[model samples]
Target: MTDTGMTAPEPTAIDETRQRELQILSEDAVLKGHPHGDEQCKNCLYYLDVDEAISYCWHPKLRVLVGQDWYCQWWEEITAEA
Candidate 1:
């Protein structure tokens, strides 16, 4: 392979202990389907849509893949910038 100056960015490493902690907190927070009709992960500020049905939660406390219809207590509505 030719030596290219470009390189892929390194992936962020999450230690096992931290990963476990986050998982526990995620479970405790009841990360699941939306409880209300209007609020869902897709509309949340932390939600990064991967497709029509799935999205990744970018919340610092909850970095995980989530369904578009799923939601959590940390959900915050995305606001438009002025």
Candidate 2:
């Protein structure tokens, strides 16, 4: 997979409006901004960078912009074939 130098989003960088529009999960709900063991958005199968500090979660249930370090219950490890 292509690397886009993804990083965590700044606190003010998150688009609250867009987040609400998409009904993105709350940080608490998704366990975001915290790593689950070695799992994170940057290493998940659904993550796609939108910019250096922002990415899109392509998971059907998410489909929201996320930070590289964000983690969710749906987090899936990216395989070599992905």
Candidate 3:
């Protein structure tokens, strides 16, 4: 994890063949930061909102407390159950 204004850490190496599989899983959860548009982390399946502003996401690579409205490329809409 890194502090604000710091460059993100180098990405973990993954098998190219499993890229799609990994993406699907990563998108299923959400991360913290400024939201990518209206894709708030609070609406994500992996978001654990601690309050109105503070929240945590079950990210595959990063696990840090963040604002509820934060988002990343791995953002995915929360699916509803039938």
Better of 1 and 3 by lDDT: 1
Tens digits of per-residue lDDT, candidate 2, 8-80, equal 5665535767666455456434656777889888888988873546688888877777888878899887889
Clashes of each: 0, 0, 1
* Reference-based TM-score of each model: 0.62, 0.61, 0.49
Candidate 3: misplaced stretches above 4 Å?
1-32
Judged by lDDT, which candidate is best?
1
Q: How close is candidate 2 to the true structure, as a TM-score?
A: 0.61
* lDDT by residue for model 3 (1-82), tens: 5568977666455665466665654465443346776877776666766355777666655465556877766656777860
Candidates sorted by TM-score, best first? 1, 2, 3
lDDT of predicted model 1: 0.77
Tens-digit lDDT track of model 1 for 1-82: 8879899775355676777876797797678766456878878888887355887788888787788888888878788961
Q: Write down the RMSD of all candidates, one decimal each.
A: 8.6, 12.4, 10.3
Q: Name the regions of candidate 1 deviating beyond 4 angstroms.
A: 1-23
